[model samples]
Target: MIRTVEVREARELLDHLLPLIASPWLYVVVFAIVAIDGFIPAMPSDPVVIGLAALSASGPPDVVMLAAVVITGGLAGDRVAYLLGRTAGHRVRNPKLVMAKQKAERALRRHGGGAILVGRFLPYGRTATAMTAGSAGLPPSRFTLHTTLAAVAWATYAIGLGRLGGETFARSPLLGAAFGIALGMVIGGAYTLVERRRAKTAAEEPEPELVASGRR
Candidate 1:
C-alpha cells in the first residue's frame, strides 16, 4: 500500500511538471541556457534540452521550434565568444584560456573542417575553437558557415535523441529523461575518447613531403 501511494504521488508530480516543461516559454528558457553555455561551459544547457525534449513526448511542445531556438542560441553564444577573443588581441594570460587556445589551434591545424564540426559535441571544444578562430583572424564567411553547420547538426542530434528516449519510455517521462541523459553521456564519452586518440596519432605522425612543400 505504501509503495502504491508513493507511485501515485510520483506520477502526480510528473503530471504537474510536464505542463511547465512543455510550455511555450520552455523554448525561450532553452534558448537562453544554450546561448549562455557557449560563454560559460559550466551551464547544463545540453541536459536541459534533452530533458525538455523528453517531456515534449507527452505534451504539445513544438519540436521544430525547440530545435530552431537551440541552434540560434548556440550560434549567438559562439559569436560572443569569438568577438571577445578577437578583441582581446594577444595579451591573454589566463592559463586555462591559453591551454584552450592551444588545443583549439592543434585541432584546427590537424582536422580543419572536422574540428569545427566535431568540436560542437565535446565539452569546451566549441568555445575554444570559436575563440581561437577569431583570434587567428579567420575570415568571417568561413567562420559563419562552419559554425552554422555545426550548430544545426548538434541541435538535430540532441533533440532526436531526446525524442527517441521519450518514445521508448512514454509511460514514464522520468525514465525517458534518465535514458536520454545516459545515452548522451555515453555518446559524448566515446566521441571524446576517439578524438583524443586521433589527435595523439596525428601528433605522432610526420607530415608528407608534398604537404611540407605546400607550407613552404
Candidate 2:
C-alpha cells in the first residue's frame, strides 16, 4: 500500500515537472549536455539524456529528435577532441588525460576497429580513444567512419533504453528515469570491468620474439 502511494505521488510530481522541460528548449539542452560530456566525462550527460528520453516516452517530446541531437552532439565533441589531440600530439601535460591516451593507443593497437566501437559505451573511453586515434595519426576518413558508427549505436541504445523504461512506467516519469539511468550505468560498468580485465591479461602476456634461422 505504501509502495503504491509513493508511486502515485511520484507520478503526480512528474506530471507537474514535465511541462516545463518538455519544450523546444529540451533538444538544445540535450545537445549541449551530450557534447560537453564528451569532453568532460564528469558531466551527468547520460542521466540528462535518459531523463529527457523518459519524458519523451511519456508525452509530447520527440524521442527521435532527442536521439539525433545526442548523436550529433557526441560526434561534434569527439571531433573536437580528435582535432585537439592531432594538434597537440604527445605534448599533453595533464597526467590523467595522458594515461587515458596511452591506454587508448594500446587498445587501438591490439583491437583495431573493435576498440573504437566498444569505447563508445564507457564514460572516459570514448574521448580517450578518439583523441588517441588522432594523436597516433590515424587517417581522418577511417576515424570518422568508425566513430560515426559508434556514436549512432550508442545513441540508439541509450534512447531505446529510456523509451522502454518510460513506457513501462508511463504513469511515473521519475520511476522511469531512475530505472533507465540505473540500467545504463550497470551496462556501462560491466563493459568497463570486462575491458579492464582483458587489457590486464593482454599486458601480462609476453610478446613473441623473432628468431633468425641459420644453416647447421
Candidate 3:
C-alpha cells in the first residue's frame, strides 16, 4: 500500500487528518511529521507544526499538551536520524556535504552537548548535529538529555509562530497563506533537485569535439 502512495495524495490525506487532530491523536500527527522531516531532509515540518498549533485553538488539545507532544515527536524523529548517522555515518563520503557536517562534528567534540544545543537553531545542523554526536561516540543518555531540551525549544518556537498566525489572521486566511508557503517551498525544492541532477549528469559527460578540417 505504501508503495503506491503519491505525494500529493499523502499531503491531501494529511490535510483531511489535520481537522481530526485532538487529544491523543495530536501526538500521532506530531510524531509522524517530525519523523518524516528527520528521516527525509526534503519534508518540511515547520508548517505542519504551525498548522497543528492553529488547529489546537479550535480543538480539544490545549497549548501545554500540544507543546509537550510536539517536543516528544521531534525528539523521537531526531533520534532516528542520529542512529542512522551513527550506524552509516562513515558511508556518506561526499566532500561537499561531508565538510559541512564535519564542522558540526568538530564542534560536538569541543563543546560536547553544547554543540547540539546550538545546532537546534540551524536548519541542516539539527539533523547533522545529532549524527555528529552519535558518530563522535557520545553516550545515548547524554544525547537524549540535550536533544530533549533542544526539541522542546524548537517545537515551541515553531508552534508559537503557527499560533500567532491563527491569532493575528482568521483561520481561513492563515490556512491559505500557510498552504501557499508550503507549496512554494515544495516547488522550489523539487526544482533544485532537478537542476542538481542535470548538473551532475552534465559534469560526467565528455564535451563535443570541433570538426577536424571543416570539410567533413
Candidate 4:
C-alpha cells in the first residue's frame, strides 16, 4: 500500500503538514480540522489529528489538551452537520439519496444512539448518520449524548494511535506520524474488504429449506 501513489502523496502531505502543526497554535489547528471534518466528509481529519498527536506525544506534554480540543471540535462539527441535515433533508431531490436517508432514518429509529456511536468510526459515516438523524427528527438531547460518547472514543483511539507511532519512532516523530496514518489506512482498508466479503457471501448463500415443516 505504501508503494501506491496515493500513499506516497499522503505521506508527503502529512510530512508537510506535521511541521506546520508543531507551534503554539497546535490546539487551534486540531480543533478546526476536527470540527470541519464533521460536516465535510472529505476533510481527512484523521490524518491531521494523528499527525499532531504524534508530534505532541514525542515533543510536548500537551497530548491531553489535544484530545480535549479534538473532542470539543468533533462535537461542535457534528452538531452543525445535524442541523444542516434537518434544514436540508426536505430539499434532497435525488431518489437514491432520499431512499438512503429513509433507510438511515429507520435504522436510527430502531437502534437509537448506538447507530450514531458506530458511525463515528466509519469513513464518512458520522456525517451521514448525524445528518440522517436530524432529518429523521431524532431528539437533540439523544443525539448530543451519543455524539459526545463517540467523540470521546474517537479522540482517545486516535491519540493512542499517534502515541504508539511516536513512541515507536522516537527519533523521528515525522516518520512516526506517517506510520500512524498508514496504519490507520491499512486498518480501514481491511475492515472495508472484510465487510464487502461478508456482504457478498450473505448475498450468495442460499436460505435453509424447511423440510420438516413440509412446505409445498
Of 2 and 4, the candidate ranking higher by TM-score: 2
In model 2, pairs of residues that clash are: none
lDDT of 4 by residue, 137-189 (tens): 77788889999999999998778888889988999988888778778778778
List candidate 2 segments past 4 Å from native: 1-20, 93-96, 206-216
Model 2 poorest ten-residue lDDT run: 207-216
Model 1: clashing residue pairs?
none
Write candidate 2's Cα lDDT for 36-94 as tens digits: 76666555566666666777876856878888899999898788878877887477666
**Highest lDDT among the candidates is held by which one?**
4
Q: Estimated TM-score per prediction?
A: 0.80, 0.81, 0.66, 0.79
Q: Rank the models by TM-score, top first.
A: 2, 1, 4, 3
In model 1, the runs with Cα more than 4 Å from the true position are: 1-19, 89-97, 206-216
TM-score of 3: 0.66
Whole-model Cα lDDT per candidate? 0.71, 0.70, 0.63, 0.72
Off by over 4 Å in 3: 1-14, 22-26, 58-61, 93-100, 170-216
Better of 1 and 2 by lDDT: 1
- Cα RMSD of all models vs. native, in order, equals 7.7, 8.4, 13.0, 7.8
In model 2, the number of clashes is 0
